[model samples]
Structures are given as structure tokens and as C-alpha cells.
Target chain A: MLKILRKEIKAFLKDRRAVMLTFLMPTILITVFALAFGSGGGDDVHKIALLVCDQDKSEITKSTINDIDSVKMIEVIPCAYDTAIDLIKKGKRTSVLIFRKGFSDSVKNLHPLPLDFKYDAARVQETGILQSILPKALFSGTVGKLITKEYFGEKLNMLDSATRYKVFAALAFGGALSDNNGKDISPEKIMRVNSTSIIAAQVGNIGLVQAVAGTAVMMLLFSLTGMGGGLLDEKEQGTLKRLLYSPVHPSQILLGKMAASIIVAIFQLSIMFIFASLVFHLHIADKILPLTILIFATAVACSGFGVFLATLARSRSQLQGMSTLIILSMSVIGGSMVPIFLMPQWMQNVSVVSINYWSIQGFYDILWRQLPIGPLFLTKVGILLAIGITLTLIAFRFFRKNVMALE
Target chain B: MIEVKNIQKSYGEIKAVKGISFSIHTGECYGLLGPNGAGKSTTINMLSTLFPPDTGEITINGLNVKTSIEEIKKILGVVPQEIALYSNFTAWENMMFWGGLHSINKTDLTKKAEELLQLVGLSDRKDEKIKGYSGGMKRRINLACALLHTPKILLLDEPTVGVDPQSRNMIFELIEQLNKDGLTIIYTTHYMEEAERLCDRIGIIDSGVILAQGTLDELKRHSEIKDVIVVECSQTPDEAYLISKLNLNVKVTDHTVYIESNDSKKDLTRCVIGCSEAGYEIHHIDIQKANLENVFLKLTGKQLRD
Candidate 1:
């Protein structure tokens, strides 16, 4: 077995295609994506620039100006109203904000009125997302803006048009979001939302990694089915008969072939590991015992499936066709292409039968989640073992029925 | 020595080898001759313990091929009709792999491989990958791999098919040399000439049955060629004119003459002085008889290759 493995590894190394597939191209893919990720690609908080046009520069206007800059989604750009509008029209800025001259005087005096502002819709849709966020944000931001109007400081609480309009707007638009429990919304709440992202970001990335790596590994099993073709190639060449006549059991030949395949599968598996680590930053820790078990079982499943595919096929072309169909269908239905959560409930329920899904879920609970140590040690390991054993036995039995008798 | 006794194999009632039996003694080459689908491969496969014969026994030196398969394997070499070699591996590597399969050690395996490559005259090309080698080179490598571990019995299935004549002759010489070294060989081929030149015994198998089996001369006796005599005379005669005038059963070519007659002495003595005067130097008188090729034809109802 060791000898077989050594030969297989040498052969794999000699193959330029495997080298390109396993190492070089994946490095390129990882480098490309990592640079893309760090740069935020096209859309993110870092790249947004906002413009504000204040026709009325007053204390209230200054306060509103301060309010506009507080939001993280926009980077403030000061400009004349016309210039701001022109910037929005030219796609130079994401959006522009305008405050008319009487906006502050009307609010300080006992005036019964409200203000309205307008801007280009095209910029808002394509480039002006940050501009439209300011008006409602400015209004909703001031805890004192919606307080009942006080007449002459006697606190004869009055409901004026401006306050009325604000109340009416709150009732109309913010009903779904209102914490009727009267919980005062604060910056702490906002900070909590942002900080929770550390864990969420980790989970999200690990999930994506598991999803992608699981698929690559599962499909890679198909590539190693070429190992089985070694047998068919030998048989086609009549070397199989020669080997049979030698002082070796036909079983030993099968053993050598399987050994060679497992070695190749190991090569492919390590490629997957490095790829996931580099591209997705797949986290592996000291829980290598479980990792080792998962890798071993996965190797078993792939090698067995390879032998099974080889036996199922009578020729190289037949193996190619049959394995292609089998591995592809399995990968698709098993959630290798898409997350099972994204599937309909019925489809998700059906995914339990998919080996890739179970293996992925096992990986999620183990490598991705790093969850409760109990589930990691027992359930995940058990399920992976079950899938691996069941699939291997199935493949072996199918091979015996189809190909062993072929000899 | 190898023994196959009434071996039979079938594939869903399509009897591939129908109760055929043959044995080869030590240091002898036994040829299995038949056409395509004649059960030659099926019989050989069963004897090699690849497929169990449905109802009989094959004993290689007292080891039943069915039960003692591993032991049988340990003592046998098989050269398949098609060069069974990993095209990606060099000749030395392939030999090492096959040698390793039989549990030969690294040092000994390399030594044996080198010697075998030298024996096959592929020593210089031993390090080159089989994929780049010619068909003959690949076949020779295949033979080398088979000969690893020095099996007592060698099974060759059409070892030379579509090979250049020089390579084929080299392979033939290799087989003879191996047989001389006490390896019992079961050689199969459709080439009647191969059997004629190499095999001490020949089995004429057809349609899953051995229709005839014996020494080359014994099988030839089964055919109706009772006599054959060739005369090397002192003179080149008008062979056709002499045949017409004397009413002789004669076949004449160049400086040689042939006759199939009940009384050889009368025909030869009468023609001797006349042929001598025609100025043909007498090299020698030679009389050769029919052999396995004739018996194979008579039984198969066709020539060997046809």
C-alpha cells in the first residue's frame, strides 16, 4: 500500500494538469478574490461620498448640517445648492441635501408649516443612495424635533403644523418599526448592531467557505474516478490478464488501484484544504483529531466511489460519462452548488439524503461553527462516519455486483 | 509442470471454455491455437486462476489453481496478448511495481529488472517511459514485468501480434531461452508458423472445445499427409515435361524437386542421372513430413490465421 501510494503521488506530481489544477490556478483565484475583497470591489461604506447644499446657514441649519455628517453611510461634501444639484446630475456625488432659507426661522417662530426637498431620482437609484438617507435621518435623529410645541415658555403644550406633520409622518411611515414599549433608541443600540458583526462576519465567511469547499471536494471525487480507468486501460491493453497470471491476486490489483486512487484523492483533498484556507480563510484549529477523521472518511468515500465508478463503467468513455452524470447530480442535489438554506423547505428536507449536504453540515458544525464541543466530538463525527461508511459500502456492493463478475 | 483437467467456464450459458483439458511439462512450450472467440483466452484465464473454471481442476505442481490461487500466482508469469503496461511508467518502474506486487524487495527488484531489461535488449531504454516506447518496446517491457520474480511457469497469450518481424523473432528467441531455463510455457497464438517453430505440443481448440491435441508430429499424423520427399539433384530438369512424360507426381522449382509417390526409390533413381546431366549441383537429399499446421487446418476446417 505504501509503495502504491508513492507511485501514485509521483504520477500525480508528473501530471502538469494536476499541478495547474491543484496549486497554480487556485492560487490565482485566491489572489484575485483576496485583493477584490480587501478593496471592497465596488460598493461599501469606505467608498461613498455625499454632498450637502445649504441655502439657509443658521443655527438650526448648522445643527442639521452636523446631523448629516453623523451618518456613516455618507462622506459629506459641502457645495452650493446649484453645484450640488449639478453634481448629482453629473453622477459626481451620490446625493445632495438642500435646506431652504426660512427653514430655521419658521421652526423658531410659531409658524404652522413643514418643509419639503427634492433631488434627482436617477442619482438616488444608481449613485445617490447616500443623499436620500439624510432627510429622514436628520428628522428622526433629533429626539427634541417631535416634542409637543410650547407656547411662550409656559409649557402650554401645543401641537403646531410642523410638529403635527412630524407626528403624522411618524404614524404613517414608522409604524412597523416603532418600539411601542417606549424603549428610547440610543447610539448604544447602533454600536451593538455594528459590534455584533464581528461574529456574524466570521460565521458568514466560514459558511461560504464550507459551501464552496464542500462542493469542490465532492466534485473532485469525480476527477479521481480516472483512477478506475487505470483498470479499464490495463484490461483494454490486456495487461490485466497478464497481472492475473502473475503471482498476485486479482484482489491485490484492485487493492493497488484503490490505493493509487486514495493517494490521488488525498492529493486533491489537500488542494481543497489549501484552497479553502487561502480563499475563504477556512479556520482549522487544535481540534485536528476531528479534522483528521473527517479528511479520512471523506477520502474513503471518494476512493470507494472511484472504484465503484470504475466497476460501473465497462470502458474509459463509459466511466467518464457515468461518473460525470453521477458526481454532477449528487453535487447539485446535495447543496454543493447552493446552500440548502436557500432551497425551498421541501428541497431542504430532501437534502438530508445528500452525502455532500451531510458532510457540509458536519463541516459546518465542526470547522465552521466551532460550536459546543459536545456536538463537535459526537454528532458531527458520527454523521460523517455514517455517510462515509454507508456510501462506501454501497459503492463496494455495487461494484461487486457489476464488475467483479465481469472478470 | 502445469496441469489443466477438463476445465470449463461459461458466461450465462455461453460456454466460453467447454471442458477443455491440456497440460504442459517443465521446459516445454505448449501452444494453444485457434481463431477469434475460440475459447483460447477463456481457457487460459481459467488456468491462470483469474476466473474459476466452472467444473474442473488446474494443478500447477500439485497446487490447484482454484484453491491455491495465490501460490499459483507466486510461481507463474503471464504475458498478455496486448502489452499490459502502464504507459506513463518507465520500463524499470513498471518492473519494480510488478515486482513489488509479488513482494520482491527494492534492491532485488531493481537488480532483477535491470537483468531482465538487458535480457530483452531494452536496457538502454529502461529509464524511458513506456508511453514513448514503440509497440515492440512496450511488449518487451510487459514481458519483463511478467518475468519478474522468476516464475516457474509462464503464460503467454499471443505475445507477438502486429509486432515487427525483428522484434517478433527476438521475442521468440526469448521464449525459447526462458523455456530452456526450465520454465513451463503455455503459449497461445493464431500464427500457425509460430506454433510450428516453437511449440513441442499443440492444442487445436475451436468454439470453446479442444478439437485436437498432441505433439506436432502426432497432430500431423491425424492429417492425411502420409509422405513428402524432396530431391536435390545434379541437374535442373524440365520438371513439368518430365512429370508429363513419366506420369510422375512431381512438383519442381528452381534447383529443387518434390515428389509424392508410393514408391520413392523408383521415381528418384530414374530421374537422378537425367537431372545430373542438366548441370544442377546436388546439395543434399531431404525428406520432410507434415506437422501441427496441417493437423490444425484439418481440424479447424480453415488455415491458422484465416
Candidate 2:
């Protein structure tokens, strides 16, 4: 047993690629996961941006904005109402807070405040966090005003009889919202929060849509990389030379493999979505056209990545080592393992470099956001195609220079 | 016809084929006989246009190898030293895949694949995956895949390595028939007998150089000895003493004395007398006509297997 163990150790050490990857894989994974999940680092915190449209322009509105912005995890950007709505429509901002014209007056007269909070329904996690934070900020702004009699007397003198009558009715409303002690009214009643989605989800669950898209792209990336290993196998078996010995060019062989891989990727994604639809009630049939196009574009990109990896490595073991490290790292950074929003702000910036980010985002637009086939959707498809084409070109060049050169 | 003019290939500091030059005529069976790492495969690779030489030229049938690689590929078939067939694929499937690379249509490719399988004597097992095949069977199929396009020239790099004798002979006969049908062939092997049996002309290469190349008779002259007298004895004779006494080249290995002879009759008589006088008891005596092995040994001062 000792002798066998020694022999195994020697053999393992001899395969430098395997040994290097054995150590490298875990080190890289732990580092990435720690960077993604660890806290206490100031820059690592993902500050959720809240767009504030303060039409009231009152002391109360200013206090509300300051209180919300004081939180370490939220950044308040004051903008006009039109600008806030535009930003939400264009997907520039996930959440928005609107203080209508009569917000400050209503607060003083003990009337229901006209405060509107709108968020993108697709970003359920981000909105949920925002929803929890928004109330505390509003309550803090109202607490100081409610504690002083001068705050109520000032608004009471400016009101007419008809308005005062309404104020009495509003006071009755506020009385019912208060707790048994009557001093501690809930944050919901304090601001009369009118929360709604800027763009509502067409699907039943946004999380399921996220799961189907994320898993599909991530798994396809892995499978396509494995398919790339076929190139190394041909090289080892000397079948690559046999193919080269034919009238075919090196580029043709690489492109042929890429094409086959793309077809397989498309098939893989189709099956994943079909399974998702049948079992999980994902509304894929309604968005079949866009989904098909997205899958094809994604497949092209992933197949390119696969061929690139195959051409990059000299042997099957090396390819295995490299593909595992690359695919896993990309999957994690690209929001396949976890949502990009949940990661550090820096990681979210880095996620755009990964192919998974674009592919998964494209699916989210169709399934979760129910986005139409417009410029935004086309841009995603274009980026994926560009990535695929560029990777294929690099793979071709590598095959010609390194592989076909017959070192 | 193929012409290789001082074609040199190098990988970094190691010159794989150092300015080696040779030519093959139409319908000629030319052999490159060398030990392992003797530039045989490098020369074949250059001729096949797998890569271009650093500073030389190769022309195949009036097309430059560097510029007209695709044209050359159309007429050349290569059987690499390693088994190049896809193991997961059956003999028929591998043939079809290779044949299809030549842009051969389905009907003709199908016909050609069947014919090649039949030629390799693997028609019955055409549908069997190659991984299940013996070394010889895989080799046979490896050769067959190259011939599906009916290339004018075939390059076989040690085609019979690790093959059983039966399959080796079968491969030999198949190559012989291909040559007889007027296909140009460049066969490389360390096995002198295979070269002697198949090639019309053979080139003996060593250390990235063609040490000697010619017809069998011409190469045999390099030995300068007509025959070798092998005397297995209880005690070996000193090589230097035997060489001086018998006036011939002598090599003593173990309990055997090998005497190279220009004149077998006179030389053999002198060898016997010399060994007797030297007190070496001869257990057996055998005479071998100087073949390529002896010629190779005489030139390189090492055994072919070395």
C-alpha cells in the first residue's frame, strides 16, 4: 500500500497541469466567493441607488432625502420627476421615490401624504431591500415634525374651513393607523406609501425566470467547453493531421467544430427551457420567438468560447484544468451563481466582461421584464454575436500558429 | 513527381530535418529507412505540406508545396505512425468522414469507403468501432482511410510498427498492390526488411542527414563486404586479433565472432583458422548475405534498433 501510494504520488506530480489545477481551482474559487460574499470592506458594499423626485421642495422632503442617503447601503440621487421616470423606463435605475406637490402640507395638517415609490419588478431582490429601507427613512423625517405642536399649528392657521373639515377627517384616519398608545404610528401610515412597479412582470415568479436563465447559460458554457475538448482528442489521436492532410484548411476544421458545438448548445438550451416550462410553469411559449433568437445568439457565443479554449490548451488534461477554472470563475462573476446586484459594486462592473452576463440578461428581459424586441434586446443579441465571432477568429489564428505548425 | 530541394525544418535550436534533399518519380516506391528520431517523419511532413520548410523548396507535380498546399493535399494521402482513426467511429464511418473531406459526393464516397474496407480485408468488420480493434486492425483501417480519395502519392510513416506478423504481411501486400497500380509511394520505416521488400529505392537517414540513398545493390556496396560470417563459440575471440589475423572487419559480441568478408570462401577459411588458433571453440557457424541491416551498421556504426 505504501509503494502504491508513492507511485500514485509520483504519477500525480508528473502531470504538471493536473497538479497546478488541483491547487489553483480551490484557491481561485475561495477568493472569488470571499470577494463576492464578504462584508466590512467599505468599497465592497453594493450601494443601491434610489432616484428621488422631490416636487414638494419642503424641509420635510429635504430631511427625508438626507435620512435615506445617510444609510451606508443607499445612494440618493435627486432628479426631476420626468428624469426619474425616464431613468426607470430606460432601466438606468431600479428604484425611485416621488414626493408629490402636497406631501409637506399633508404632513403638517395630518392628512394622507402623496408619496409615490416605483421600482422595477424584475429586480425583486433589489426592490425588496429598497422597500425595507425606504420606510425607516420616511418615519425618521416625520417623527421630528410630529413631536412639536408648532409644526401642526403653522399648517392649521393657513387652512380654510373646508380644508380644516378635511383635516379633521384626516386626523380620524391617522388616529386609526396609530397603535394602542397612539404615539407610535407604523411607518406605512406615516407616509401613506404608494408602492408599485414601473414595469410589472409577465411571469408568475421572477426568481424562477432568473433560475432558468442563469442555469441554462451557466450549464451551456460548461458543456460547450467540454465539447471543445474534442479538438484536443483529435490532436492526440493524430486525426487532426489526417484532417489537415485533406484539402480542408485549418480554419475550416475549427469552424466546423464550432458550428457543431453551437447546434448542440442550442439543443441544450432548448431542452432546459422546455423542462423549465413543463415542470416550473415558466411562460416560455408566449415569448418563443425572442427566446429562440436569444438562445441561438447565446449558443454562438458559447461555442466560440469552447473552440477558443480547445485551441488554447495543448492537451486534454490541460484543457480540463483551464476550462474548469475559466467556466466556474465566469459563472460566478457573471451572476449565474448569484445575482450581480447582490455582489460587490466592483464585481457587478466586472460581470459585463463575462458572456453569461449578456446571455442571462437577454433571457431576463424576455421572461421577467417582458421587454419587446426593441433596440435594447437587439443590442444584447449583437454583443453576444460579436463575442462569438471574435472568439472564433482567435481560435482559428491559434490553431494555425500553434497547432497546425506541428511543433 | 515530387522534388525536395535542400528542405530544412527546425523547432527552436533542434533541426529536425537539416537540409535533406531527395526526389521521387511518378509511380515509384521510395523508402526512407532510419532509426527513430532520424528525420524520416520530418521529411514526410515537409513533403505532405503539414508545414513549410524554413528555407527550402518542395514541388509536387509542378505545384509549389508552400503556395499550393491545397492542390498537393488533393493528390497526397498520409498514414501517420500513430493510429489516426476516430476510435468511437466504425471503420465505415471513419472512411466516409475522411473521404468526405476531399469533397467526394455521397454516392462515390460510399462506394470508395466500401472498396477501401474490402482492400484492407476488413469488409466484414466495417461496422465495428475501431477501439475494439487489435493493433493490426486499427493500423489496417488507418491506412484504408487515407486511400479513400485515391491519392496519387501515399506517405506511410512506419506503417507496420507494433503490428502482428499476419497483419504486417497483409499491409505489405496491400502497399505492393497499390504501388503496382502506378501510385507513387514514400514509405518510412526503421525495419530494413520491410523497406527492402517494398521500396524500389531506399534512403538511409541518420542525425537529420541522408547518410546514403540508392538501389539495394548500390547501398549494399557501402558495406564493402560481400557476406558476414557469424561464429558462435564457447569463448569469444578478441576483435582486434581476429581482424589482424583474418584481414577482415571483425565484431565480437558475447560468445559470437562476426567477420565481414569481401570474399566469403577465402575469408570464412581464414576466420575458422584464426578462431581455432586463438583457442575459441566454435559452437556454430552461419553465413549471411550482406543485407540493408549490415549496410546500415557499417555506415552508422550502430545497430538499426539503436
Candidate 3:
């Protein structure tokens, strides 16, 4: 076994790419993702400026301005139709509302409606807000028309008292709203908050961040299984046999191979964590040490699992195939690809046994939420450590049973 | 220093090495000679303690392979047919690590690895990756890796099989020198010439059985023919048919022909008479004794190529 292990280490040294894949590549990716894509605080909200053009100077047009700015949620600026259109086309403003000529006169006369509003069809958000406020603005315009027709009934053209009474009612309300300028009350408003629970702003969804980072880290660790191929390559060359001709048992070979893989995994995880903290602004809070320990244990177990896989595999290609199936399954079930909590309830039930789930979950608890590390968290850590140890033992035993023929 | 009595190994229904027995005395270069697929490797693998034979009682320097694999491993060096050295590593690095496997102390390992590298005529290329080395250079490094621990017995399985003549000669010389230094060597090869030149005692094994085992001279003495007659001819010549027409005791190849018999003079006189009647051209003939190929043919009644 010692013979096989030495040969495996030498083989790994021969493949510089394997070493890089094992350690450096992960470090580079983690750092790049964390630093380049990292943004702290809540995600940036979309900003839009709404511009209004009143080509017609009328009470109906003025009420439209009031309706647009009534919510005070968006900034509304009054400008010429051409200026507003150019600003919107240039993206200086996201939307422009234009009220054409004869809008107020046509509404007051109560003949065929002559009001027209033009807006950018491409501005989805602005268009939606504008659509919601259209009814309020039109109602306000109608009230202005009713007032003018009723107060000036004898001075103008009105035939029935029923219509006269209706005009009086409209004038009574419109007179108050008109003198107050274009500031009118809107019947519609938007509300955008729904949360069953809320955490502090400093954390900034730490659990989700950890889940994504941890998944990447664990999947990258699977490449260490290439060390098994190193073993098979040596055996083919007869270097393996030369090693086995020594006074060493096969267990020693497994131990050495596992050692190299674990070291690589450790380096990989540390790189990700450091990059996450320094570049991505991932908060470790007071649980940095515990998270580091958790990552270390995960690496150890996974590397041992890699060696065991190498032992069972007949060839390098076979080992790769097996490693893919095994590592991916663990990651998927463990919440490396998807957070275990987000998975279906049945899948979550399955994740309790997954190595990735435990490793990723532990990291999230330690780094993101900054919750206390009491006995419950301690038990989860214990389970992870136990799993790592068990895999090592089984893998070592497998090497002992089969490595005799390596020579 | 190696002995086997009734060793048998099988893979499922296929019998790889069937009830074979042989021995290699201390300081003796023993050869296991056979054609391809004759189970020479199966026999050697068992002797190396790589895996135990299914039915066997074997001893290496008084240590049984089945019961004392650890002891057997300590006293033997193995060079497999394939070049096992890592091309990515320097020749010296390969040797050092292999030596380390035997628990050789770090200080001793460095000195020993350097010596083996130098011996293989690769002292200058010791630090270069074996990947760039020629086939012969890699073979030399392979031998170097095996010798790192300086095992008393060397089990080399066709170490010079695919090398050029120069490299093959170098390997043979190295093996001879190692034997001179009191190393017991068990060399296996399909090349009969290698066995003839390198082995002190040769075992002709075919079909998992030893057909003959003795010194070269002793085995040659068993051949009835003392001389071979040569009849050089063109590759397209109908020599076999012409010889059969004459009813002469003769065998013809594209390059030469052999007329083997105790009465060479009488046979030649009859051959001239028969050839004259057939009107076939007569080529000069000189008789000579049989070599290993002929001896194999005489014993098996089948060509070695066949």
C-alpha cells in the first residue's frame, strides 16, 4: 500500500493540471466570483423618472399631472412634448405622458371626447403605473366638465333640471380640487412587502450565499478522485509492482493517497471562505472558526471517499464515472446545488443523510445567520465528523483487502 | 534461492499455470522461455508473491510465498516487462520514492538512487522527466527503480522485450553483471536468443508445462542431428515440392534449406541423383548441426511461429 501511495503522489506531481484543478483553480474561481460579483446590502432597485408633457393648457391636462404625481413614489417632471420624448428615448427619463391640444376645452363642452395621452410602449413598469392611475385622472377631468356646465347653465346651454342638479354636485367638488392646484387624491396605490420572517440588514441573506459557495466548493473537491487514476497508471507502468515489492502493506498506500487529496480539499475550502469574506463581503460573524472546522471535516471525509472510490474502480475512466455519480448525487441531495430547505419536503427528508447537505447547512449556520452555536449545532457538527471518520475507516479497510495485487 | 513444487493457478475455468515446478539456486540466472500465451507471466507472477497460487508450496530462501509474503518481498527486486517509471519524474526521483517504499532511510536512499541511475548510464539524465526519454532510457530507469532496495534476487519478466539491439545488449550486460555480484535472477522471455545468451540454466516451458530444463549444452546434446545442410534459394522457389519429388530428407525456407541426417555423404549422393532426374537446379549444400528452433520443431512437430 505504501508503494502504491508513493507512486500515486509521484503520478500526481507528474500531472500539473491535476494539482491545479485540485487546489488553484478553485481558489481562482472563488476569488473571482466573490470579488467581482459581490455586492453588499439589498440588491439594487430599479430607478425610473416619469416625464409629463402638457401640449394643451387646460384643467383636464392639469388633473392628469396631479394623478401622475399623486403617489409621490416616482419623480414627475413637466416638459415640452418633444423634450419629454427625447429624454425618454435617450433613457434620461423612462416614461413620458403627453396630453394633446383641446383636451380641457372638449371635456368642459361635454361634446365628443378630445383628450389624448401618448406614452412609450417599451416602458413596462412606467406603463403599468400609468395604466393604474388612468381612471382617477379621467374621473377628475369629468368632474371639472360637470362643474362648468352646471354653474353656467343659464349662461350656457342646459335644457333639464335633472342635468342641472348633476352639474351642481360635480361643481361643488371640482371647485375645491381646482383651487388647490394640480394636487389631487388617487384611489389606487402599490404595496410591495410580504415576509413571514425578517432578519437584520447586516446579514444580507447569508444562508443563500453560503449554499451557493459551499456547493461549488464541494463539487470541486470531487476532482481529487483523480488520484485514483494515478494509482492505476502506476500499476500499468509496473512502478506500482516495484513499490509493492517492499515491506509495506496496502493500507499505507490508501493512507498516502487520501492524505494528498484531503490537503487539496482543505486548501480549496479555505480559498473559497477567505475569498467570500474578503471579496464578497460574506460575514463570518463570530463563527469563523467553527465554519472552518466544518469545512475541514468535510474535506477529510470527501477525500477519503475519493480514495475508496479509487480502490474500487478498475481503471481511471471507471473511477471518474463513479466519482461523478457519487459526488453529484451527494451534492444534489445535500443542498449543494439547491438548498435542502428549498427542496420538496420529501427531498429534504432525504437530505438529512447527505454529506453535502450537512456540510453546507453547517456553513450557513456558522456564517450567514450568526445564530448561537449551542448543542443543536454541535450535534450536527458531530454527525459530519462521524461520517468523515466512518468513510475513512471503510476506505482504509477496502485498501487493505484489495491492494495486495497492486504489485 | 527460489523453489516451486506443484504450483497451480486458474482464473475461473481457465487454467493459467498448471501444476508447474522449478527451482533457481543462489547466484544462478534461470530462464523461463516460451512462446506468447504460454503462461510464462502467470508463473513469474506467482514467484514474485504478487498473488498466491491456487495450489502450490513455494519457498524463497526458506520463506513460503503463501505464509511469508512479507519475508519474500524483502529479498527480491522485480522489473516488469512494461516500463513502469513515471515519465513525469526524473529517473532519480522515481528511484528514491521506490526505495522509500521499502522503508530505506532517506540518507541511504539518495546515495543508492544516484548509484543505480549512474549504472543505467543515465546519471546525466537523472533529473530530466522520463517522458522525454527514449524507450531504452525509460527501460533503464525501470531497472533502476527495481534495484533501489538492492534485493538479492531479481525477477525480471521480459525486461528487454521491445528494446533495440543496442539497448537489449546493454540490459543483458547489466543482468550478467548483477549475477556476477551474487544476485539470483529469474528472467522470462519469449525470445529464445535472450534465454540462450543470458540464462545459466534454461527451462523451455510451453502450454503451462516444462518440456525441457537444463544447461544449453545439455539440451543441445539431446538433438539427434549433428549438422545442417544449406540450400539457399529464391523466396519463389518450389523447393519443398522439388525436394519431395526427389524423396530427399530436406526442409526449405526462403533463405536456406536444411538436410538433417546421420549419413550426410550418402544423402547428398542420393540427392544429386534425384535432382538430375527432376531437372531442378542444384545449389551447393553444406551440413550443420540444429539450433534451438530446430530442436523445438523436432520435439513439438510444430513450427515455433505456428
Best by lDDT: 2
- Candidate 2 lDDT (Cα, 0 to 1): 0.83
Cα deviation of B249, candidate 2, in Å: 8.0
Q: Candidate 2 lDDT, tens digit per residue, A62-143?
A: 8768888888788899988888877776566787888889877877766667878888888778888887666545444453
Each model's lDDT comes to 0.65, 0.83, 0.65
Task: Choose 1 or 3, whichever is better by DockQ.
Answer: 1
User: Lowest lDDT 10-mer window, candidate 1 chain B?
Assistant: B220-229
Query: Which candidate order results from sorting by TM-score in descending order?
Result: 2, 1, 3
Rate residue B56 of model 2 by lDDT.
85
* Fraction of native contacts (fnat) of each candidate: 0.86, 0.91, 0.77
lDDT of 1 by residue, B53-165 (tens): 88988888999877888888888787776777778888888888788888888888888988988989999988899999887877777788888898888888888877888
Per-chain TM-score of chain B, candidate 1? 0.83
Q: After superposing candidate 3, which stretches have Cα over 4 Å from the reference?
A: A1-202, A371-374, A396-407, B221-289, B299-306
* Docking level of model 1: acceptable
Displacement of the residue B62 alpha carbon in candidate 1, Å: 1.9
Residues A15-101 of candidate 1: C-alpha lDDT, one tens digit per residue: 865666578655654543333223324344433455666677777777767776777655667788777755543323435555567
lDDT of 3 by residue, A235-339 (tens): 666666666656767667667777787788888877776776777767665666787677677777677667767767766766765676566666656657654
Off by over 4 Å in 2: A1-15, A40-44, A142-179, A182-190, B229-260, B263-285
Off by over 4 Å in 1: A1-207, A285-289, A394-401, A405-407, B226-258, B261-292
